[model samples]
Target: MIRNEIKIKSEEGELFDKKQIALAIRNSTFEDDLKCSLLEDGILDKCQGCSLKYICNGIDQVVDSYMEKTTEIVNNFNFD
Candidate 1:
């Protein structure tokens, strides 16, 4: 799924492209999947009990997957 067309940009500059991100998402292992699991799944929920949950936007595993390596060029990118 991950081709070689996407453009990856970091704060400094573009780091990767679309295809690369798709590859990473597809190659995710069980543990890797678990790391970003949602609160209902257990991962984020634990954060809720922890002190940092308040600030943590909670892992958006879905978005993590949906966007995976390719982020659509929204109207604005807030890198803050």
Candidate 2:
């Protein structure tokens, strides 16, 4: 459902505009989906008996951090 009219090139030889990229990213599914998939696949359980869980903010916090960083990137990315 993406519109084909969104096209802009940057000064450094970029072929797409930041706004267009942002819109495409905004419409994509991510963040929670990845978290759920990783959790369900037992990836988060790797920290169940880790000694550095507290120091590393635990697996849940790590996943939350990933989601936060993804959101930040999708919100602040630029073609430049």
- Give the candidate number with the greatest lDDT: 1
Full-model lDDT for every candidate: 0.54, 0.53
Deviating ranges (above 4 Å) for candidate 2: 1-4, 9-15, 30-80
Query: After superposition on all CA atoms, what RMSD does each candidate show versus the true structure?
Result: 14.1, 14.8
| Cα error, candidate 1, residue 10 (Å) | 13
Candidate 1 structure quality by residue, lDDT tens digits, 1-80:
44364576679996667556655555453235534346567655466466655534433454365555565676976799
**Poorest 10 consecutive residues by lDDT, candidate 2:** 27-36
lDDT of 2 by residue, 1-80 (tens): 65554675568764766666444444444532223344568767665775665744554464565457775533655697
Best by TM-score: 1
Residue 71 miss distance in model 2 (angstroms): 8.0
